[model samples]
Target chain A: MYTESNEKKLDEIISHYPVKRSAILPALYIAQDEHGHVTDDDIRYLAKRLDMRVNEVEEVVTFYSMYSRKPIGKYKLQVCRTLSCMLQGAEQITEHISHKLGCEIGGTTPDGKFTLQEVECLGYCDLAPCLQVNFDYHEKISTESVDQLIDSLK
Target chain B: MTKVLTSRFDLKGEACDIDVYLKTGGYQALAKSLKELKPEQVLDEVKKSALRGRGGAGFPTGMKWSFVPKESKRPKYVVCNADESEPGTGKDRDLMRYDPHQLIEGMVIAAYCLNAKDNYIYIRGEYWYIKEILEKAIAQAYERGYLGKNVLGSGFECNLYVHPGAGAYICGEETALLESLEGKRGHPRLKPPFPAVVGLYGGPTVVNNVETLAAVPWIIINGGEAYKALGTEKSGGTKMFTVSGHVARPGNYEVPMGYPLMKLINEDCGGIPGGRKLKAVIPGGSSVPIITAEESEKVNMDYESVGTVGSMLGSGGVIVMDETTDIFETTRNVTHFYKHESCGWCTPCREGTRWLYKVFERMHRYEGRPGDVELLDDLADKILGKSFCPLGDAAAMPVQSAIKKFREDFDRRIKHTLVQINKAAD
Candidate 1:
């Protein structure tokens, strides 16, 4: 179900690289952006577009953490739970978000407004206890701030 | 002791804008390199400066460039490692955010030295915002004829692109980076055909860190000896130390190589927050050995000094722990990171990391066995140098060091658990 415009954009991405297969990562990103996750159908479309076996695209989807095999929530709250952030209460923040949303770490809220994830270091340790909501970084967050963020998201 | 690399950082009024960069003497080095010096001469100057790769390994930059085969028939490549996925490291993000064109200018010069027609900056997927900043800067560079199609009329062409990494820490490793760039999973290839010998697209390639490439402009402009005069005998030039965790001023501090570790913590970072006493420090990134708090004060922020203290000056990611910190819990957290990031290429790394994390997880829950520590030591010994890449060794180093240096913490956990079990039995 690749649109004409999407196919055009794919062409531009392919033109940037000497080898056409190098376009797979960026192509997957585009598909994920449109679909919120890569489904079997999206994988088939990408495999055909990039001229690869379906297993090749599926391997990529499984290997990297960012690509979601299942549909994700509107606001994916990826909290930094690595060393520096953990030391500064990232675990507490994750628990707080998970509790407020009535969902587990990787599960979406019942309303599907939020998905809480405990991620490794986002490399923004100076502002520890950070979380990214849909690629927008919210640094040095607290439970209270996360509460406010959830309120603001809806 | 002037601020060479970070001279324009944190300045007001569109810090990353092209006009602001130009006003602060941005492309002058690029112009000079294209107009005045030969590519070999540029390489020689970097060689003389003794700039080490800032992406953890600290290999000499000029020496790395010298490895790119001069007679290769295939198209050479220069891949800039902007992944910066190591825990406690945020300096590269700051560099890309605040001073984008500086990195671009550095990459241009580096590409020239290697005779590479095209270059790529493989950045972490999380830093999409910073990557946008870099792309804007690159567009501006091209508009001004600084990047593409015979850059600055020097009869040399250079094209630069930004590639986003899809959330894998192993891609930060040079060989894995090339694999990911080539649309494969981020598994690091075996050495002997090192990247310099056969890299991206089966061509002789040179992979350098973003921080290493960014220093090229300054080295070329001020000359190599001047840059060399900035730091210690072997470690020359200023390094961006990412001082985080338990510090008052948790931020990126660019200091000369031989800067005192205590001074950086006390003066620059305003010491530990809330006046807590220091317990220990990961003087480099989490992969390196952790130095005890007592030894950290005597440490210098250089390669040799940190190494002499039994830890390499890795990635300049200084993670400080205060008296209130729990060594056992922190070790579990660190172990968990390696276990999650191990690429599963080698059996030792894949299995060793998983078991290492499981042992720590059990201990944190007070279910540690009597010989768990010995079990850990044996597993680490088996994994140390046997894996395909450093991922296995990285998992082993900090865990091994923590158990050795802080055995009391592990003993305490086991004893507390056993006491609870006996009380329940009674």
Candidate 2:
């Protein structure tokens, strides 16, 4: 399942590091981009390409929060519930999204349109009550405007 | 008063791009170091500058660099820690977004000083855009002869690469950063073999913060003493404080060390919103102990001054709280953050943060018993010094300090709940 173009990107990433094992994280990112999420086959392919054990590759994948072992929704709404964001009413924003989507914090919507998660600081405290749909940030969002944000996502 | 690091942040033209950076005197310090100064001379200048680490600890940057052995058969490395995952810290992300080349130039100078030809920047996964910006800047630097083989024709060759992390807050730790860079799970290794001795494939390595490294170019250009003169004796140069929560103008402001904490909040940050009364302040990131508004007024934004007031100037993140802010809810939110971020490597941290959060949740839900506050303090006390890393203590200190400074507020919540229960029974 490792395409030729994916292989080229892996090679370019590996070129930067002195050891091939150091390329595992970047290679996994590329593999995840190619596939929806990291699969067993992707791990096997990465282990073979990087000359690492399958367990080593899987260990790295499982440890990180961002890498999804299972498929995620189209739009991942990662609401920052850290201290700074919390002060700016991030909890209400999170609760509103959860109630509106009819899914739990970590659950995806029935239509598979969005996956709502309460993530740690996204490092944008100035614009508190921020959440990221994929990597795009929506800052200083209110519970009132959250409906518009969800509607506009499509 | 002087803003060196962020002066170019809002400059006309493409501020982040390479051409604008070079045009506005980028890489001049690197050129100067390679042409005029020897590697030892550069190190000496940094040592004289007294610039502490901008990353949480405030360790002397020059001393950290000096720890790297002069001779090592193994390949040496310079790792720029762009993994700014701390709760109230976003200044590094700003630097990476607006001035990526400054970080590269800083790393290049550090590598030349340490004789390290290879460097990797371990950036957070969420900062994908920042990484891309850094990569673009690196490409431009290579094309411009500021980076890559025989940089500036000085025969001081160095290569810099941006390595993206996979969403682990622990990777921000230097040892954990090295482990993650080696493509392993981010677990903090023991410190006896600190990165300076055996690091990054068994070689001497120097791990500096984004702001710390970015400050190097200015320090070198302006001369060490000139940079040192900006701040207090031990804490040199201006620090970029990320002011957030309740502040009218919540953003990053680079001010000299020893700047009055209250003055920073009132003047630079436009004071608290709605002209509300100040209650508490988290002088540093959320990890440090909380300080009262009265205590904050007496303190200055420096390592020693903040410490003298019984809290640290950790990461220079000033999280202000107003009178309208509920102490119980704020403490609960903070405890929840630490509980979520615990790496699970340490038992006290893993278990203690969870327990603390549960107790806070109970208190939040009006299930607070008489001894709940004492229980909170007891749990925090147990976790403070028992953990392997600073995170456990980070979670504990804010809880402990909140109880110390705002016990009356939490007590009022518990007393009010009792009154409601009595009234219902009657």
Candidate 3:
């Protein structure tokens, strides 16, 4: 999905680290930034450029959960449900969102508007029961807040 | 001259020999522990100090040490998690490279108290230079009888080895670290049989961070009350803040717990580089949420206090961001990291991370529909707390927190990108 320009910037970043493996993390970031997910072709491109094996790149991409092997919905919703958030009632919010969006964690909605996912620690323990919609965070979440928030979506 | 937030860094050309570390008042704690205080006494002193783990999670240190079984048949073990893979943090390399003996002495003391026979420093693969330095220290330690059979002739024999990780960030996690040390995939195992009962070849193992164990030698040397006097009530002892990013004098700044973040940045770190106005900061390492400039001002570099401002004292990595930077792009960088690093052992993490990254990409491309922000918030809420490991949670935290605190910026970036696209078309 990247243009030739995006590919060039990725190549430049790959050159910073001595070991090709060290460049993998930054390379994957750049590739994913260009393409929605890192495909086999992208891994091969990076592996070849970094002088690393394609399997190595593929192994790393598969090892990390963030690499999307398939196309995902337009919007991704990550909800925090760790000890801190759970103690703050993350379960209630989880059910409300799933029911309203008609999707479960890792399940894209039928309409393709959103895909719901549960996460561990969003690190904002202060604002428990928080969810990150795209790159934004809506904190102190509840059923009503989840509905109002979800309703605002196109 | 770099500030002495790190004992080893302070020893620049200070000497790698045991004599050098000892001259700088090394092993004084062990001397105190052996000569004056008993083993349980040393442990009690740490308990009273209220020192917590320096690893990402601020689990109480003394509390973790006490987890070692009082009665166990097999040999107890102390495994140091020196695999510092958290990006934007690099203080561990400084310590290992300079003050090798300091950590060596700390491990010996820890082994003595826990009644463990062997210790392992699980250094990351990238740190060959550090590995060599530590190996030299190990050889010197053995030659001087600081290690090996009957160490210091107290009938306490402990052997220390340096183990290198192939390359896995999850190995930084304790259970996963144990798995990697055992030469297995670094996926987290089911808890309930926590590391205390069965860990590292299925024995009573106490795994600690390099910085965590390094503090032990000093703790044993000083009375618990003496260490307690240095920091605030809940968080005691000095911590290494690896300040980077916009900070001018960025490096390791050693400050006692509860040190004000503002003062540490301004007075110690010499404020931001280029005198750029402070924007936000990742108080801990990558796993902790980002705090705004105002919130960072109210923060203290401790476990409990930093939490009050919606961030953590994670690994004591202070990453400062100036106002000119974009928060969305910053978090997008972080999300991209988690997505690339998540070891798809669990469903929530594997699928969630992929989706989150995709959405960010769309937004970056000026393809976000109206109400895209709400969709992102929804996705972050869904993926957090449901994963098998902290990786998933960490991936979601910065994205959510950055967006929550700096939604306007993301909106602006999204709007600005779209405007440019339309103008180019015209």
TM-score result, candidate 2:
0.96
Model 1, range B278-324, lDDT digits (tens) per residue? Answer: 99999888899888988898889999999887898999999999999
Provide the lowest-lDDT 10-residue window in model 3 chain A: A13-22
Q: Ten consecutive residues with minimal summed lDDT in candidate 2 chain A?
A: A1-10
Q: Chain B TM-score per candidate, please.
A: 0.97, 0.96, 0.94
The local lDDT score (0 to 100) that residue B173 gets in candidate 3 is: 90
Regarding TM-score, does 2 or 3 come out ahead? 2
Worst lDDT run of 10 residues, candidate 3 chain B, spans B1-10
Model 2 chain B weakest lDDT span, ten residues long: B409-418
DockQ of candidate 3 (2 decimals): 0.02
Candidate 2: tens digits of C-alpha lDDT, residues B170-213 = 88889989999998988888788989999998899999999999
Whole-model lDDT values for every prediction:
0.89, 0.89, 0.74
Instruction: Give the docking tier of candidate 1.
Output: high
Q: What share of the true interface contacts does each candidate keep?
A: 0.81, 0.82, 0.00
Q: Write the per-residue lDDT of candidate 1 for residues A7-95, one digit (tens) a residue.
A: 78889888878888788888888898888889899899888878889999899889999999998899999999899998898988888
Global Cα lDDT for candidate 2 = 0.89
DockQ of each: 0.88, 0.83, 0.02
